[model samples]
Target: MTVSTATGPLRPRVRFTGLARLSPRAGVVASASLIFILVMSLVLPAVTGYGPDQFVDLPYQAPSLAHPFGTDGFGRDVMVRTFAASRVDYLIPLLIVAISVIIGCVVGVAVTLIGGFAEWIMMRVTDAIIAFPFLILILALVVVFGQTVNVPFLPNGTIPIIVAVVLTGWAYYARLARSQTLSLREMDYITAARIMGYSTARIVFRHITPKVLGASVSYAIGDLIVVMGLIASLSLFGAGIAPPTAEWGQMMFEGRSVLDQYWWVTVFPLLFIIVSAVSLAAIAERLVARLEGRTQ
Candidate 1:
């Protein structure tokens, strides 16, 4: 006679072991790196004795126990300036992303929901904006506006950059949201909501927007790294944040003159930029992977 088999709830088994765990491990490390950078940026100013523009050291001083990242050509501590620059380097992209996402999602959802002429006009406008070369358009706006508009809270010189970036950046999100909305609008749940006599606004907001937002958000994460680079490039070209601001691009520009002798001046800023971009990019990748259900 066969022994009676016992049937019970199955135990959960390990899904990832050894090499299979690398992706999650990398994601954790990337997240940790991002958090560390953000925390250091926020906390360093309070804890460190030297201010970003404080010139307590000799010009082009090499890295030392006293001045960790060395001094710039102006005799200012590189470490302090790097930390100070972190504020804008982080802030501008964040602001750009926020503004773009809001405007884009609203316009995209509205146009898609309304359809017909409104959608046509908005699509044409978006196409026109997209037709222009990205960097050139930003430069044109900055140059045309003369880069001196005084916004309430932002730095005096940053108004044009913000305006330009926001104007240019939002189109991408709008297009993305529209594409997602078009597809999501046809889903069974959306049709069911319509059949259930839900108002158009409720159906779009409650049902469609959330699904579209996920993809848009993933794109925004990747776009942050790009926006940061663009800001740095603008500063490098003398069109972004001005001097005395301790921005990474400006810092690198200042150090270019004596790069051979005083490598740390430029090197530190460059290193910081690279690290910031890489960390953001890694986080974006993980986010996209998780959104796509590829993450284990």
Candidate 2:
């Protein structure tokens, strides 16, 4: 029943009508910053002709036109490595969050649809997972799985970390999805679908899912940055992507020892993390507003 926009009705159970004009200029800045990071991380590494591990200059060289972010302890270009790290730092969380959302929405909707004993058991299980100290749980899981797990094309510890984060992260989305589904089920479209003899699957998928999904997406956008930080934090504990592979956390961990004399190594990587996270956050803020019809 709450599907209409301020102007008029859009679609039943669909909160989204169409794109809103983003009033905030911050969105453009955020988008540009994100684009720069993507280009630096994904494209220019090849153009620069420097491997992230390549010792291109004397170690600890200060920033220059040749080496804009200077060089680190191993003479690896700090600029290249920082951006290169984004490939892992950025992509991993996006992947983890995406998988979590899929699993969560399925579990959430399923539990509600099933009802009774099975639903009770699953919600209890989800609660248990969510109640635990998430970081410690992820660390322990990463360590346990990383020892035995390796996948082709994935960096070391990548698969294990993904497995660990997703294992814990999905519970959150499930709770969100379940709450959304509970409200949506009371809406007229769902009641009509039930009365019309539409298959349970059709009603749920066609009607409920589109509506429930928006909430999950809104919930998860901010989590992408959270998961990125988590992965970077893990690297500091010696459980990240391993040495020689440039990860922002790993770079920061290595640079901290010499940071008193060499600020570039630590500061540059940390700055990238900050800028990227801030950009993402800005985008998410406007996007959520855009979704909720709060924006002009």
Candidate 3:
């Protein structure tokens, strides 16, 4: 309440902290979308009862209630194949983000903590990697590696793409983490830790690392969908996972040849990619917004 002698009623000052500052609408939509994506990508695919390679009908049949996505040239259900592709499509990006974050954070944190020539060298290396057009490098690596690599355990295309993407992917997060860490170095507590003669490892790990990692990891979550798109796009150039694997890009590539005559083959997979991408992207976009809000 305003003081009785006050000239006018005082307005309530808004505090931008915690939940109050975040958008309820965005939070709700993101939660629902995450649940939907998890269910569709993980749960529904398991229960579909059609293997991506199984023959289900005559080749090139039109879409119907039974086969919602129609039959492909090999008589496989296109819808089932699209769902099956989730293992390849989603998993690669998930692994990429997780691996990148781990490798990047270690390198980033070390370089920032070390200082001097070590830091200078690593930063230059990361900068050089980052300076390249990201997509071009990853694609180039994938194409080159796909030809020469032969491993009994890994699929032909998977190994090459993973190597290519990871080679370039971690550098981005390393740079980002370094930038975040540089700011932390100037903070009073970090300076005090140095003045107090705290061990480098102890000070960085105990005080500074937590603060640096939270932001990097949160931002990494938003980067997931972008990585997924890049992996999917690989199939467009016939450089992704080979046939019989049920990847979305491969499906789209094959379907494109017959798109005019048999539209469902191409349309359904495209629709799946669009719907899933949009859904996952909604979550990513909101998270990034909230993160920006935190910084501000």
Candidate 4:
């Protein structure tokens, strides 16, 4: 007796184009490094015994195996303080960046949906905000709100600073989104959709939003570094992160007094700030190229 076994059908094969097959090598490396640094920032605090303000060494000690990054003017372990400080410093820019994107996207979509004199007025308002020096804008807000205020969620005043940054930062994204929308609004496809009786809301959210997001996302990534720098500058100037926080900017400020002795105190924080900023910008550069559909 001859018996034949039944077999299941095979799955479809997947293929990739040249561009899709190749990955952004530089961006991947930069992103990986940044992620590693962020993770270390969290985990390092656990193994260390000293806190940011808990001094444990002779003041102004240079780099040693016991201290690693050495002791600051207050005799605090630099490594421990840096790790502890990461929680605040890192989160501030991350929060600001996220808030900025949300505000920008909303304002951009709104300006596009409602055009004419209203759009002009809103655009001008955005321009006015953007025209102010970034640090000056932040300082102005910090002074008015007393640097820290109670928020519905977060107990710390950092939320207030994040809100202020977001408020002023969205203008550029709005302008960019509006320009792209203006060009897209007059497209033949949009005209067809309009003629087909599609609702304005549907067109804006369903069709326009996705297309404009590419530009806005690219813009937001680039803007984050600028925001972080402004935050650091404010912290250095005593307009940000109140006492007891081991922020990089505050560290820099503290280092200024002991520059002749404890260079590591200042150097390490500056190095951290620079590395974080550069890694982000490097990734952003690759992303911008990808978003614009450009090749090597």
Candidate 5:
């Protein structure tokens, strides 16, 4: 006679209730803000009917019926430029986040799965990159690369900024992914898969990647907010997108000298930047809560 044992349904070792819950009101507000920004970015350009660089009136003109945001130092329409710059402001951060996340995830997962020498090498390199001050690294890269590289579809001067931001940004995602993967690799399911003779590549791609991507995606949303500020700061300091491009940072930089007299020049762009960053950050927080299974 032989004895048999029964197995029960698997349960998680740790419940995420504390980490996952987010306020419903906050979620609603964040969603609404993001939607408003997205709509404004798409709609304002067409409705305004003023070219960003087009001179609508004399310089230093304050907000009025014709030029709602007033004219800048160069007589360009601040309202039009502000709206036009929305496209770049939104686009650059998004592209940077996407590129960085993808590269980081791939590298992180690969190093974790391969382990040993590869893991050591990638982590060291990532650490070294991270050790540098973020702003200085970006500025250095921008200076070395020069700010005029043009890609087929992107704006003429945006390539350098994109490159620098992506380079500096990916390390965070990589570290996040690696840490998540490390914990996930020891899970019962992963061990079961390994015991079942599944190939390493199949296990890594099919099982491991999904579990690790959740946190990375959430972090990327928050990272977008930081990247937006960085881009604006770069432009404000004379190393961002060039003139006539209508980027918010460049606009603020150009208007700084005349800020005392023509407040609209810098204020409007600064307002938009703040709104966009805060809205995106709120959304990211909600997403993190949701991803971690928090509910109120």
Candidate 6:
């Protein structure tokens, strides 16, 4: 199905009710915010009146027309790095959340299809994983892998964060899918399809999974922002993307000592992170509202 929105031209309706229509506003704002950041980040390498790492002004320059966000402790342009680091900072969380969601869908399907004692066992194991404080579990994983382990799939250090996120975050998706599947399996359409001799796999995969996907996807919108914030928090604590990288959390960490002196260094990056999070959260809220038929 397709859906239309209040902004721009009409688009296809996605069948979410009520408040889901508001998702367009959220989506547009989020997209605009990210795009603005991305454009700045991507162009930083090319269009530098001042380099992110190069000292251009006196230390702790206040915001001005020339240096809109002011200068940092090292006199590096705060605005430049904030824009430049946008891609690197956002990229990790985006990747982590995508990987986690994919893993969630796979695990969710498996848990539901297996049912019986197997389901119980799998869920308990998942519950254990879920019960861990997210920060503590992440810290433990970092210790096991060491602070800077290279990923087998990616040459960079990003793989570890992705792995950590997927491993820790799937339980919720699994439970959601399993619960939905349990109820769906007993529905008349599924029963009729089964009676007509559809293979168990076909009924489960084709009939049940598709219906649940809409709800799962809507849920995932919320989860994405949560994942972003979690990753940023980890970064602030020193387990996320490392230094010399333009990640918002790391930027905040780098600026702490000089914050009283170079407040803009910390403030701009933190502001970007907050804006991005709020935008995504808005989108998720709209999606939930629409799905629940409360969009009006």
Best by TM-score: 2
Evaluated at residue 45, the lDDT of candidate 6 is: 53
Instruction: For candidate 2, write residues 47-89 as lDDT tens digits.
Output: 8997898999999999999999999998899998998888888
TM-score of 1: 0.86
Give lDDT tens digits, candidate 4, residues 1-296.
Answer: 01111111121211122333255575676688777877877777676755668879898888999899999887889988876666666677777877776676667766677788877787777767766566665567667776457665342446546766777777666666677777888889889988999987788878887887766665566666776676667766567766666778878887988787778998998888887776776677676667769853
Candidates' TM-scores? 0.86, 0.87, 0.79, 0.83, 0.85, 0.80
Ten residues in sequence with the least summed lDDT for candidate 6: 1-10
TM-score computed on alpha carbons, candidate 6:
0.80
Ranking of predictions according to TM-score: 2, 1, 5, 4, 6, 3
Q: Per-residue lDDT for 11-121 in model 1, tens only?
A: 122122332345666557766776777677767767876678778878888999988898887889888888778788888888988898888887787788778999888
When 4 and 5 are scored with TM-score, the better candidate is 5
Candidate 5 residue pairs in backbone clash? 20-294, 21-294
lDDT of 4 at 211: 83
Top-scoring candidate (lDDT): 2
- What C-alpha lDDT do the candidate models reach, one value each? 0.74, 0.76, 0.68, 0.69, 0.74, 0.67
Off by over 4 Å in 3: 1-27, 41-48, 133-155, 195-197, 294-296
Residue lDDT tens for model 3, 1-296? 01111111121222223432365464565557545644565564467676778898899889888787789999998877877677777667777778877787767767788889987887777656655666676567766675446776444577767776677767766666677777888889889998999988887678766766676654565556667777667777767777777777788888888889998888877776776565555555555566678531
Q: What is the alpha-carbon lDDT for the whole of candidate 4?
A: 0.69
In terms of lDDT, model 6 sits at 0.67
> Candidate 2: where is the Cα deviation over 4 Å?
1-23
Name the lDDT value of residue 3 in candidate 1. Answer: 11
